[model samples]
Target chain A: MFDQLVAKLPVGICVVDEQYRLQYLNAFFLDRMRPDQRHNYLQQPLISIFPEQAKFLTRRIKSVFVLQHPSFSYWEQRAHIFPFKSSRPITGEETQMYQNMEIVPISGPSSEQKLACIILQDVTAQASYLMAQQELASALKQEHTAQRKLIKKLDSAQSQLIQAEKMASTGQLAAGIAHEINNPIGFVTANLATLKDYSEQLLNLCDALADKLQVTSPSLAQFSAQTMDTYHYELLKEDISPLVDESCEGLNRVRDIVENLKQFALEESTGWQLFNLHETTQQLVKLVGAQYKAPVYKVSCNPPNLQIFCEPASIKQALTNILINAAQSIKCKGFVKIDIRATAQRVSIKVIDSGVGISAENIKKIFDPFFTTKPEGMGQGLGLSVAYTAIEKHKGKIIANSNPGRGTVVEILVPVVHPEQRHECAEPLGGS
Target chain B: MSTESVLTADQRDALQELMNISMGQAANSLAHLIETKIGISIPKIASVTPEQLFSMISEQADAYYTRQSFLGDIQGEVMSVVSQQGLCEVGALLEYDAPLSQTDIQEIILELSNILAGACLAGLSAQLALGTNLNMPTLFSPRKANFEEFQWSNSLVMEVQFDIEISSFSMRVVFCLDDASLDRLTQTLDELLG
Candidate 1:
């Protein structure tokens, strides 16, 4: 009964000797073999029967014989060690059988003869199911990574859109305000000049009348002098001219501010042309220095006459904005150095300032519109953002590095726009 | 109360001697098979809680682990910790090619554990006149195991180490018998002492 059960077991059982020659094959193994080989396979070398897996099979069988212990081969490492077809060949997805082989040392009844028993278990279904699940898991992981990258891209693009929209509307608002202020400034400036001349002439006429009255009638002159003394006429003559001069100066300041607002709105006629970077830096230093006198400004350029093809008006405005920030960053005394270096394809403008630098957190949002650290009513916070927009038009970028209280370095990297590509940028550089 | 006290002084001494002989045989079997000089250290016997067992085995960061179970006159499990250093040299001596694959490395660890553990068990059982059969070994991760939830609070453990002279690699095997098997082992040792 035990012999019958061994021959009829579901698992494949093959007995190979110490020499790895076949000794016996159970019915399970014989059923998978060819009809001719089934009867003749006895006494044949196991390697001759399965030459492809000969090296591996012999090594494992040899280990069992030497160590007098069991040796195992899992389906995960060496699947389908045997040349056997799947039992469920018609319905199974896999063509070959996945086998887990175990070779254990067994001694014959004589005790002198040693043999190894090879037990092979079919694990095709389990192997296939695990592989399919692993594939699905890796595919899901790849899809998740792709989605995360897309979400990050969308977030940055959306923020840029918001910034562009804000800049467009602000540009229109500035243009409108500049127009209204321009008219009043124009008339007020002209009237201040005429008032200055009129006040000077009236003071001279009063002086001449007082001298004539003193010579014409002595007693009448005496009464007139008494009247002049009561009114403090001598003090009035000395202060009148200076008052008119100061009023004219204040009016001129109003006109200069209105001019700047108009430039901020962007002039529609500005076009791409060759502009000298060296000269622009000099002009910018002079202009800002007049207003902020505390910070000493310095300008340097490589290849002294480096002329880059760009929109002169907008480029000037961008530099003016950056220089103003550099000047304002200083409270009492500091130096602002402007360095312009040009490569074959781009020009780098570095503005280094020895002033209170930006903090780490606020540096990121410096290009964002209305992001300011200034006290209320002191700054509009549109300077750096407008500069960023202008540089973006020229396919450029700005990098700011600051050490909180130490200093700040702002680098504007702008691509050199050649005149040949001017037609590609047909749109007027009116509103950045 | 304690695993050491579970056996009388004579039985403990007998058991310790038996363990030394078996471990020496195990090291000799492996050295003969691999054609290398393998050294064995005196086996240490202890009774430990789950936490102690975890700390003892999980202390090595760079080691591969395997666990096998045997059933027969006594039932218990054997855990092996193999150092990863100089494993490739050992693999070459075992007729494996250099630049071993992931599967090759795993197979080496499992096969090496099986040989040492099987030899030790077979030798020890033979001395006690008991029959034991060892099952296949599988890869194990001590970090992932929840030692606190183990059913046994304390168990007698026989620990031994095998050092390969050809490389820096060393293997430590720990044997832990079940509660019922411990009683059987002690009784068998007593009879042998008599």
Candidate 2:
């Protein structure tokens, strides 16, 4: 009855003598081995029966016999000590059995004789489930990283959109102001010219009346001359024309400024059109120079009148931003030069200035929105960033080179025709 | 308190001999259950502060620790330190399945401590003609802060080591007697000697 119970045990049990020769095999152990090998395994060395695990088995068994204690081995460290198939070989996830083996020293019926017992237990399902969980965790980590990067891109794009909207509203405001100023300037200009003509007629009438009075009566003429002397008539006649001329010139200047503001705003047509690069550079210099009077503004155009098809207002805005930056960089009495060069298919505008140059560190972040060196409320630091966006729209490149306390140079290159339409044009100019 | 002051030379000798015999019985019980040869070292007796006791147990790196308490004629706690190496072999001998989970390892530590500590306590109690009840075992980590905060100023410690011949496996068991238990133990030793 005891033998039958031991044979039916779920665990694999085998007994080996001190020399490691197999003495007994329970039914669980016999079932795992081939029928022929099972019958012949008795009295055979344990190594010969499972030659592949001979070294490991021998070591464990020897230790058990010498120390007279139990030795343990787990599947985690060494999965299968013996090459055996899983109990559910047909439906199991693992092809081979994952075994935990233990060798224990046992005394025979007589305490003098020593024997080693080997026990095996299978555990494959637990290991497979753990591995699957680890794989899922790693995949989730990768997905989380990708999502973070996409969110960062979306954040930058949203800020750029907001900046563009602000620029559009500012342009509309400028256009409205220019239109209102033009109305008053028109009438003021006309009334000043009419007043100048009416004053000349009044002076001519006074001169004729004095001449007639001198001829008609010497006393009356003498009285009239005395009255004219008391009124300082000669000085008044000399200053009137010069005053009218200066007033007219000043009004003309104001009109010119209003005209430039209207052109800069370009609210009438934002569409693409042919634009003269040299002309745009000159206008940018004038507009910026008015505010930053410390800089001596100069313009140079090689093969003048280089024209490119682009959005005129936007190009002007880009150049204006760069020119103003150059002028403002000067503390006092420095030169700002605008050089325009054109190839057969492209145009390059370079704004060079002798001013307090940017530091090496600040130059790198100058084009990033809201990165400013100026004191609070003095500058918004959006100038270069706005220019960068406008130039990008034209499929152009802009670069800045500067040295601290020396000077700065900003260069912009734009295709003569928009890049998308350049293929239609037979010749393309290479510009740097 | 010093070891000599706690117990006279005769009392110390008598307790040491009794501990040796009880430890041997504990090892035999484990050997009988696993059908393996288990060797035990003679027990060493000492009077130690909590810090000393902590260092003695925690000095063994990569070892599993457990604590059990007993009550009745003697009141004391038993701490067992088992090496992590060759644990798989021990697990198999106990009929545990392969690829032992964390819980399985914990269970093995607890069961091993209970068997060895229980047997030693039972043997000592039987020989002394004292009645004692062993409590369940629990896993313990010997952290310095916790040891420093322990309420006892000093304890009488009896320590022993068990080595298994079949595998490179060894465990140390430490017995600590509370103040009242120490008095009881010395009184019982004197009676035995007399």
Number of the top TM-score candidate: 1
- Choose the strongest candidate by lDDT: 1
State which docking tier applies to candidate 2: incorrect
Q: Candidate 1: where is the Cα deviation over 4 Å?
A: A1-8, A27-37, A83-96, A148-198, A218-243, A262-432
Write one digit per residue (lDDT tens) for candidate 1, span A361-419: 99999987677898998765677877887788888899999998878999999987788
* DockQ, every prediction: 0.45, 0.07
Q: Model 1 — TM-score against the truth? A: 0.75
Q: Which residue pairs clash in candidate 1?
A: none
Off by over 4 Å in 2: A1-124, A207-235, A267-274, A301-303, A310-317, A344-347, A376-382, A389-396, A414-432, B1-194
